[model samples]
Target: MRIVFIPVASPLHDEKAVQELIHQYKESVKDVDSFTHLITSEEDVQSVNIRQDDVALIGVLTGGTEHLILAIAMRVRATALLPHPTQNSLPASIEAQSRLSLSGYPSVIIKEWPPEASIRSYVKSWKVVRSLKNYVFGLLGQPSPWLVYSSGHDIEKELEERLGISFKFISLDEVYHEYGLIMDDEARELAVQITSRAVDVEVPMNEVIKSVKLYLAIRKILEREGIKAFTIRCFDIIKSLDTTACLPLALLNSEGFVAGCEGDVPALLSMVILKELTGKPGFMGNIAWVENNRFLLAHCTVPLDLPTKYKLRTHFESGRGVGISGIVEERTKVTLFRVDPLTQSMRVVKGKVISGFPQSNQHCRTQLWIESSDSIKLVTEPIGNHYVLVYGDYYEELKWVAEAMDLYLL
Candidate 1:
């Protein structure tokens, strides 16, 4: 994984404590060469010529400490990791350094973080995995909206410096203009077929041709550079095409291409992770959820090659946080939970199970009365909070799908 090591350090008093943090990450990631290091510093970083063939990535640590400046100058690169709010928990000097570095880039501000230390660690690890996947990439079609920024150079620089992946830039015009010159006859035929479908759908035949050409261009570039995996910005290009073109595009997604709609970082990340885990082409989608006092999230995993069937059932509910639920169309699974009526104590009566998928219209109801002698304590547990009864198994699959898309887990 291409991890970025940014050690939070103090700007004043010339402290070396921050450097220790960097070493800690380095120690944890034994294969340090597979990572990009950014040292936070106040001064201008020094100069060190680094070849793409030698290092997997180049990142300048920018936030606190002089060490970061030296490191940044040596590597001479800028990336998203340089702008995080790591200094929030640090001492005043380090915090001030971080504030200065993030002055202009408000979007870089940290809005969300894990509540638990363990969760934070996992999330960070996931980020590294995401970065590694995006490093080596290709452009299949037109420029994605996310790439439309101040300059094309900025995107190229980000690809080169952060991921160490060189881009084979091709404009929509060139792809439409000289597609016939493409060397691979077989690939060209496929491209032509895709282009023909694109035209039938009113997708600006020229732009479709351009996208096909771009894909061809990227294949050649990746082979020459010995790079594997890539993200193509297909949103803008696709919008130009009519709705009918969606089918072929969707089919391409199934063929192991790391594609994205708008240049969504999380989508790209999820696609890469899913490919690694399932060895299949992945597309970003949301989990189906049923609202309740507590929300439950869930999703279903179906093998592409097989015909499968399953069921779902909900046995109980929890009173503390929002209860969530999920279900899949073809598989059978059930999730159950319960809350003590008097104390509102919650428990997971059941988790994941496979049987026959639960019927969507079935309603589950349990009567409770605090005044009753036997069930008084149980009935009163949830008395203070508003009560909402939801009976369904669709929430689990939806919740999992939401998480896969990096949706907020509340």
Candidate 2:
């Protein structure tokens, strides 16, 4: 059994007494695989047989909760230590001493707290470590818009060869849906609270409800599946929940659970790795936009507000053969383009496409041009009507254009 020791000491100042507490507790749970003992007092740590116990340690100090969380995470093999309701305000030195004690490990949070959001973050992360432990990889991500790029079968095969364990792609959606049927009091209350916020009623409330449903369903699914860490897209829904969920969610994270925006796979992967490497919540990715001559792709670790530049400024040229067209803005990249039945083309004569919209002068063609850093211009024709621009970082965004459009990179 995993043993997580969360110490709750008072503001008393007896270093030796604190040392005794650590020794006593360590001795009592020494038989477990590992111990995650939270030290809130300045106590001299006991000399437990490290090799015999295979101990991994994590320290949670009062001031460095984030750092402490990360420190303990590095020693993940440690047992699941519960937070003692008492030691809420431990000092920094104790936290440091505790972390020093447990190093080089992997951990799993026993309970999914806060109760508002799901613990998929924890479940999915442990799944990775567990897969690694079992010698498996190639774990495909669950199907969610945010996780669309994550490939499970690929990860599974990789892990199997790399680590020796195998992971099967399983859909958490089924159970998620089932769980949605029985909403809990807190969930309903959360939903009601969301509705109480002034929202655009004309926009279907079903989406909001679906998000609430997803939040509730995810927790149930995690509970039933015994998953420790996972990721999902919840920005739209989460933001809609307003500020009420922030404080509560932060509290949950302080206890070890994780959460993020837009189910971004890289962000999820990054956070998981960070947790394993350091023992703290993972931070989200920065947003980026990339464009060649043909299409524009938008990307971010969290759910993004599609840049205003890309907002459609004109109706379709023929309303049949053409699609939407506008400017796209990434962090530093920007482009103006229009979509036709064949391809999504970039601007040739800056406002030309706009003019074509019944007197707007926007260029509406299937061909695109890219400007090189050296000021050289390279115009590319459609490859059977589509352009392909390489994302310098593979994580860049690009639009899915129709047939007949062509792209070129200069």
Please give the clash total of every predicted structure, in order.
Answer: 56, 66
Instruction: Assess the local accuracy of residue 163 in candidate 2 as a C-alpha lDDT between 0 and 100.
Output: 33
Task: Report how far off residue 277 is in candidate 2 (Å).
Answer: 4.2
- Alpha carbon lDDT of each predicted model: 0.33, 0.32
Show where candidate 1 strays beyond 4 Å. 1-134, 139-168, 177-227, 233-252, 286-329, 332-410
lDDT digits (tens) for residues 1-410 of candidate 1: 33233343444423454455455445443333344333334332332223322222212123334344334323422222222235433233244335536543111122222212322333343444345534555544444443332124554465365445455444544433343465444444654554343212323434334444445554555456554554444333333421112222233454555544333333343455444433555423222222222222221211121112212111222111101122233222322322221221322211222222323332211111111121222233322211111123323332332232233322
Residue range 116-142, candidate 2, lDDT tens digits: 121223323233344335321112234
Per-residue lDDT, model 2, residue 26, is 52
> Which candidate number has the best lDDT?
1
